[model samples]
Each structure stands twice: as structure tokens, then as C-alpha cells.
Target chain A: MMILGPAHASPENIATMRELMGLDHSIPVQFIHYMGQLLKGDLGYSYHAGSPVSQELLRRFPATFELTTFAFVLMVLCSLPLGVVSGYYRNKTPDNVISVFTVMGLSMPTFWFGLLLIYIFFYKLGLAPPPMGRLSPDVAFPPRVTGLLLVDTLLNGDLKAFLSAFHQLILPGVTLAFFNLAIIVRTLKADLIETLEEDYIRTARAMGIGVKKVLLRHAFRNALLPTVTMIGAIYGSLLGGAVLTEVVFSWPGVGMYAVQSIRYLDYAGLQGFIIFYVIIFALITLLVDISYRWIDPRVQLD
Target chain B: MKEVLLEIRNLQTHFKTDEGEARAVNGVDLKVPKGETLGLVGESGCGKSVTALSIMRLVPEPPGRIIGGEIIFDGQDILKLREAEMRRMRGNTLSMIFQEPMTAMNPVYRIGSQMAEVIQLHQKVSKKEAMDRALDMLHKVGIPDPKQRLREYPHQISGGMRQRVLIAMALSSHPKMVIADEPTTALDVTIQAQILDLMNQLKEEMGTSNLLITHDLGVIFEMAQWVAVMYAGKIVEYAAVSDLFSQPLHPYTTGLMNSIPQIDQPVPKDKMLRSIPGMVPSLFDLLEGCTFQDRCNHVFDRCRREEPGLADLGSGHMVRCWLHG
Candidate 1:
């Protein structure tokens, strides 16, 4: 009521606002009512946005999703080959360099890395688009086909706008990717080194199979089992909107929305966002479990 | 020399440690005669497995390396062969059945695929054909429901079954020589006997020479025509299995025999089963003379002065001891 009600409202006005918003009920009754509203896909009203909390969250989700997807692809692409090379040539020069970089990536704060990327790529090099909203001020909003600006612009046959959105995405996406690369790389290297020493790997080698086949077909799959668990954790943080990365880049993501809600003490918005985060974390865990079953049949996910 | 399948001469496999270079297989010489089982018997940590791994070219490098050796397989010095050539020779010309059955096959992959991979590595065959060959090998190894077993992962099967699958994989390409390094050491007693029986049957059927490395003298007597007793990285005795069992020439060989608790002649409860005194000498700091000099009951001045060369007694018996020399 303090946040949603009029500024400096009297006690009578505050009580009326509370009753109107159904906050007058007992705690248990309020919980049941909230659950009912949640089941019906109503995340209450966000007076701050002059709309439902769910609608506000839905509008912002795709922006975060697009950034997360791009960053995820980058992290996987960069880390896999790096990890494989480092692990295969363990204690060699390549492994040593990669190990140093991965250690740095892990220890550095996500926001700190984000600032460094911006300083180098944005301020000094001027290669990046201005890090603010999703697009520049003059670019007309594309049709909300997928709610992702890049796809929407391309769908609208606006190649110019698509390029702008894509250009705007790269800086933030890379920042997020660099921050999370350490986990996947570290896990992959450790697992690959250990997996290479397994008796089965020796068996594979003894079978006249080439080294590449032995590493990839035999050893790599076994290595993936442990790496999958770590990937889930990294992925969950990415999917959870990487608040630090989001804040540093000013990327219009769900993380920023939650930050704004917290700043304003938007009760319904904060509650809905927290619940959504819980769901996302749980869903990512489920995905990891499912993938484990697929990768290694011995894993009894069922 | 009945047309040796594999021969090791002056094989020196050393492992670099913080202390010094540990000579795991030092100046060893042996041969696996074609179509015959040559049992390599030794106590634990006596370089038996290391010798087998050296022959297979599967020793992990950096910490362990073949410093100097000639592993002549099919008359070619494999130590000089390119990695690609060595790889081609492995599992096709020579297969190795490792000591631990539970860990020999990848836990994640199906038995069928693992076996098919080996089959396909040597033979230019379709995936389906390779899988069929794998199923055929599984059947040949006497696995019940070979089709179902192939689809199951290594962890799904019992240890004996895993060993059977390993054996099937090793024999799928009809390798010229199979180095079975303690093939049944990890199995239960009954399972051990069964594996040995399967190995025996497979050996005769395939007509492949065997380098069966084991500590069990009974297994040697049952399966091997000839036996080489290794003690601290060197073979102390090489003889026909019957001759060695009848008259163990080296003191280490005699000690090994005396330690076996005979089922027919159980000792009285008051008397303990005999055991060899003293530990195997550290490979890093071996004695200047015989490796077993410190432990040998018949250690003499000459034994202390110099290590005895393997002296060839008549009837194909060789002993590395001063008494025999």
C-alpha cells in the first residue's frame, strides 16, 4: 500500500487500498488466495507498471532469453575446444595458458569483467554499440512477433534494424559468456584428464582405434557426464538473468526488472519474479538429469 | 623356439619418481611361442603387469616410459613402429585383456557398441555388420541372450559377464596374440575357474598364442605349457609348467610353491601356512647383486658379489641362481 497507494496517504485511505487489493485477509487465507490466482496465471497487479505482474514479466523475458541464448552458445563454443585441448595436452604450454585464463575467469567478479570488456571494446576500441537499451533511440520498434528484437526486425524485413539489434547484443552476450566460461572449462578439463586414465580408455587404445576416436567417441562421452552437472549450474545462473552482467551492461532483462521492483519495493513484482526464478532453476536441474540419462545409459534418470 | 609370436629383449621400462628412476621391467627377456600359453607368474608389484602393458604398448607415459627395449611382434620391432602402425597392430594383431574386468570396458557405452568398435577398427565393415560380429563373438563366448547383453552397459552385467564381454572384444578380430594380464584375478573363485576354462577353450579354438600373466601357480599348471617366474623385475626361472611345478629351480619359485595351501594335504592347525620372508626390493634402490639375495635362504658370497645370469639347464629349464649356474 505504501508503494502502490498515493503519496502521503491518510490511514483511512491506506486501509481502503489494502482492503481493495485483498491484503485485508488472514495470512493463511491470503496464501490460499494467492495460490489460486497463481494457478489461474494471475501474478497479481503491478500498479507501478499499470498492468499485471505476469504481463510485465512476459514482456521482458524474451530480451533476457535472447541474450542468454547468445551467451550460452558463445560459452559452449569457446570452452569446449579450449577445455579439450587443455585436458588432452595437460601440463603442456597450451594447458598452462588455458589454466591461467580459466583461473582468472573464475576469480574475477562478473561485473568487474563486464566493466573491463566495455572499457576495451566500447570506450577504447569503439567497436561496440552504445550499451544502454536493446536498440538506438531512432530505430522504430519492430513487430513483436517473437518479442526478440533481432528476430522481429528480420521478420519485418528490416535488415538495417536487425543488424543494429545484433550489433547491440554482442557486447553484453560476450561479457556474460566470458564470466561463465571458467566453470565449463574447469569441469571439462578435470573430467577429461580423469576419464583419459580410465581402464576403458586404455581398452579403447588397445583396440587399434585412432587417438581422436578414442578421445571423442570413448573418452569424451564419459567426460561429459560430470561436466553436465556443472553446465546445469552455469546454465541456471545464465537463465536466472545474470543480474550482475545485466546491471553492468544496462541490458533490458528480467534481472533489471527485478532490480527496479526491489528499488521501488514493488511487492507483487518481486514475489512473481522470485517464484519464476525458482521454477527456472528447477527446470534447468530437470534438463540436466534428462541429459545425463541420454549421455550415459547407466544413469537411471527414469 | 617354436616360431615365437611376440618377443621381448633387454626390455627396460622405467618410471620416473621424485626419488629416482624405478626400473619396473629391467633387462627382461621372454617369448610367447605361437599357439601355446606362456604363463608369467609372480608376486604383486613384481613388474608382471608392467611387462604385459609394455608388450601391448599401453603404458601411460611421462611417469612411466619404455626407456630401452625391443618388443618384436611378428618379427617387427614394434618399439620402432610409428604410432599409427602400433595402433593398427593393437587389438587386431594383438589384443590385451586387462586385470580388472569391472573397469576394462567403458561404463557408459553398451557392450555391443564397444565390441563393434574394436571389430570395425580392423575390418572395413558396415555398422550393422560389425554389430553382428559383436553379437557373434558374444555368443561364441557362451553369453546367454547375447543380443540383450550387447544392448546393456558394462555396469548392468556381473563381473564374470564383463570379463566374458572383454574376452569377446579381445577375440573378435582374431588377434594373433592375446596378452591376458591377470584375466581372472578380480573374479570370484567359481567365476575365476569358469573364466580360465573359457580362456582355455578360446585359446585352442582360436589357435592364438597366449601371454597369461598371473600369480596363481595352479592357473599356470592348468593353462600354460611353459611358465616364467618373475621376481623383482627379472625372470628368475623359465621352465615347462610340469617341470617347474615338479622341481621349482629358483628359490623364489620354490617359495611360491610352498606358499600355496594344498587342498589335498591340509597342514595341522598348530603349523602356519608357509610364506616367503622379507619384501620385494624397491626397484629404485635394488641390490648390486641378485634382487632376491636379501630374502634367499641360500644367499652366498658369490650371490652377494654378483647377480647370476639365467643358466640354461637341460630339457628347457632356465634358472637365475648361483646354485643352478
Candidate 2:
């Protein structure tokens, strides 16, 4: 619709677009042709990029994947311990402080938060690298081993390049992760509080199990079920948030590519990006469902 | 007389609630002799469960607390012991079987792992050795196909089976005293009987003293040798189970016995089943005089003005009432 809607108005591309839209063939035939092309890994050409949409996607996707992966790791590492502490010391001073921070995190706009972080770390403190691209302007691109800049740099055995890449990643990675971390912590804390009240927790305590074992083995394991589901839900939206984050950081990722494609009326590039996002989201949902059974034996997958 | 395994002197446990301070266990004194079941019987909210939890030092803090008391078990004042020391005492010298077996054991873990964890927590044993002990305990609890049952989660088992597993876990360590808080309340009548029988048999086998908390007089009659009748957070009556049944001195005990339907003796068609009038007094607003005076039939001037203490009547039978005094 997007392609046809624009193509119908353009005088020059109209003839070629109509031919590509299968004006000579029946609708079912056109549908089948489209499916065949999709199945054969052909997403058509992006006129904006002056290349195939699939090739453009392949080039940009690794950056977004790497950024999202780093952000996700940061979210889990930061949120789990914070959530556990907050929930364990519920209604206390620490919990109150964390609650305020999380509320601010949840309410604050992602773009605004990204700008604020950049202002603090880059401008005020001058601790962070500039919000440019995935690597410094001066450094040449490392050998593409896994396509992740960090991995590729480390694999190339260039510690200096790896360190510089890591520095460039921190701001954007934290910007993408902060909101997700807040969400995870809040949900995890709520789940942990409920889990702590379960009769089995009392049973664990009654069995002379120490505080740490009771929290980690019994309470936290059970609490993680809901948090895992939350992660899957949050991860899909994180991609959406990544667009603004990428724009703010000026990071070369699929989100920025999609934004430029939309601005330039690159219909094929936009369609390809949507499809890829859906596929990744679906895969993550499947992984979360499988993890539920692992975390809670009572949850039967079948 | 048997040696005292657990001694409570003026034990008081209160809860700070929005309404007021709920005197859950108010200055209650009791004793459980070694290898004997001491039944603490009362209606709901009579502090039977609180007393049991107090003995285990498992009362939920902030809201519930032991204000003033000495719970001397195995020659140590548990209240005086540090948190770490108290933890060691739990599942080692003292273990507890909760009321609801269905939700008592963790649903996520297998029965064997939960049982084995308890063993490993208290004893210096390898995982394999602990697992072997768990299997042995499961067999002792009369669970069919013990090997398979050990690997199954709590939800996979029946209510009766879960209670049996709880019994096995509680007794696995052979603790000096086991606090069974209404252990058979959530089971069917037949299952209740089976569990009660198993507990009694296990108690005899292990020679472990039990502080059985229940509302059922029938359960007390079957399981307990020493009976403590509680009324609104105080032990209003203490006596041998047989003596208490034969000669209930406290008005509350009399009301309890009278309320129990006699199956063999047919009731008159016109007469309704006798129920104790009024309700258990709220612990939050306890009266200055007797806690049970509002419900007692034998209320007099002294009963309304001054509270009566537990008066000895003979043969170790005691009753807290103006009539007894």
C-alpha cells in the first residue's frame, strides 16, 4: 500500500512501479510472486540507499543487534540486584529511594532521558566519548568477525580499538538500558515481595536455610518467572525506544536506517525493517516461554 | 513424670496492628514432656497457632513479636539466642510441620531436593548421601514408588501424600521437639485420620516430643497426653487429656466439651446442638477481668471484676476460673 500509494502519484516511476506491482497479472499471481520473492530472500531495492533493501538491512542490523544486546546485558545486571535489595528491604529507606528513582525512570521520556545522560556524562563531566558513530572518527573499522564492533575489535586483538569501541558504546547503551532497567526492577521487586510471602519461603526459613540461599534459590528463582515474561514484553518496545536513542547518539544502527528510509520514502527498506523486528520479537517470546518452564517446574509448557 | 523437653514461663507474644496491639499469646505458661504430645486446643483465634510459632521463634516480626517470655527448649532460652543460633536450632534441635501441606513445600523444587536441602543444611553430608536419606524418609512416610515420588513436584502429589512428605521431612532429623500446627486441618477426614495415625506412630518411633496445635477435641483426645485449653491468648485450662475430658473445670473447656456432638447418644428432636454463646474475644481489645467471662455461663461478681489465675485442682489438673479458685 505504502509503495503503491506513493508510486501512483509519481509520473516517471509510475510505469515501472505498475509493472513491478504486476498490473499485467492477476492479484493471486502477484501475491504468490511477492511471497516467492520474500522466500528467496529478495526484499526489493531501496531507491534511497541506491542498493538492495536486504543488503542495506544486513549491513545495519549488526549494529542494532550489538547495541540491544549490550543494553539488555546492562539491564539484567543492574536491575536484578537492585530489585532484590529493594524488595528484600521493602518500605525501608533504600526501597523508598529506589522507588523514587524508578518512578522518575518510568515517567521520564526516553529521548529526554537520553539527552540528559549525554549532557551529564559527555558535556558536564566529559567522562563519556562523543555521541558520534559506533567507532571513533579517526580509527579504521576493525575486521568483521561477528559483525559486533566490540567482538570484532577484540577478535582482531586490538585492545586499544576494543577499549575505544566500548567507550563509544557506554552512553547509547546506558540510554537504551536505563528505562528497561527501571521497569525490570519494579516488576522484579513486586514479584519478589509476593514470592517472599509464599508459604514455601516460610518453609525454607523454617528449614534453617540462611537468608542468602532462601532469597536466591527459593524466592528469587520463583520471582524470575514473571520478570522473564516482562523482559520479553519490554524487549519488543526496547527496539522502538532504540530509534530515538540511535538518533540522539548518532549511532549507525537499523533504527537510524529505518528513520532515514521513512524520511526519504524508502518503502521497501521500511517494510523489511518491520518484518525483521517482528521475527526477532517472535523468537524472543518463544525463548521466554521456554525459560518459564525452566524457572518454574509447576509451569507445564505443553 | 517425664522430663520436660520444652518449658514456657509467662510467654507473651503481641502484634502491633493498625487497630491496636493484639495480645496474641498473653502470659501463657505450658510444658511439653519429652516423647509426649502436648495438645494446645482452642477455637480459631484462641492463640494455639501463635503459641506454636512462638516456640519455633518463627513469628512474623514487626507485626508479631515475643514481648516478654522465656521459651527454654533443650536448656537454651531461644529468645536470648542470636539469629544465627536460632537458625541452627531450627530443622536441627527443633522442626515444624505447618497446617497446609498443599502449599507448605515449595512448588518449584522436587520433593527430594527440598528434603535433601534440609538434611544438608543441618548435617555434614554429600548431596548423594542426603538424597539417600531423603529416599529412606520417603519410604518411611509410606509413599508408594519412593524413587519416582522423590523426583515429582509438590503439585503432582495428593494432599495426603504431601502431608506425609511433610511428616517425613520434619522427623528426618529426629529433633527433640516438633511443632505440628494443625497438621491435618487441610486434609479429608480419612486423610486426616491417616496423617494423625502416622504422626503418632512416628512420634513413638522417633521418641520426639510434639506440641500439637489443633481446634479438634477428637484429635487432641487421640494424639495428646497433656492438654492445654486456650482462651483468647491465655491457657485457661491445663490437665491430662483424660482428666480434662472427665472433669473440665474452666467454663470455656466445659463449653467446648458440651458443644461436641455425641454420636452414640441421640439428641432430642426439639433440642438444637449446643454452641457456646458469644464469640472469642478480640485480642486487640481484651477486657480487664477474664477474657472468657463474656461467653462464660458461670459469670459472677469476682469473674467480672478480677481475673483468675491457673489454680491447681489435683493430679496435675489446673483450671483458670473463679469457680476453680
Candidate 2 contains a number of clashing pairs equal to: 0
Task: Say which candidate scores most in lDDT.
Answer: 1
Task: Report how far off residue B181 is in candidate 1 (Å).
Answer: 0.6
Q: What DockQ does each listed candidate score?
A: 0.80, 0.73
lDDT by residue (A1-75, candidate 2, tens digit) is 345575466766777766764656888987787678889988877877888888987888788888888898888
| Per-residue alpha-carbon lDDT of candidate 1 for residues B71-109, written as tens digits (9 for 90 to 100) | 898999999988988898899989999889998898887
- The TM-scores that each candidate's chain B achieves against the reference are 0.97, 0.98
Displacement of the residue A194 alpha carbon in candidate 2, Å: 0.9
lDDT of 2 by residue, B1-325 (tens): 5889999989999999999999999999999999999999999987888888888788889889899989899888889999999999888889999999888888889999999999998889999999999999989889999999989999999999998998888877879889999999999999999899988988888899999999999999999999999988899999999999988888889889988989988896876578899977888878888988888888988887898998888888988898879
User: Could you tell me which residue pairs clash in candidate 1?
Assistant: none
List the lowest-lDDT window of 10 residues for candidate 1 chain B.
B266-275
Best by DockQ: 1
Write down the TM-score of every candidate. Answer: 0.95, 0.94
- Where does model 1 exceed 4 Å of error? A1-40, B266-270
Candidate 2 stretches with Cα past 4 Å from truth are A1-42, A239-241
- Residue-level lDDT for A23 in candidate 1: 82
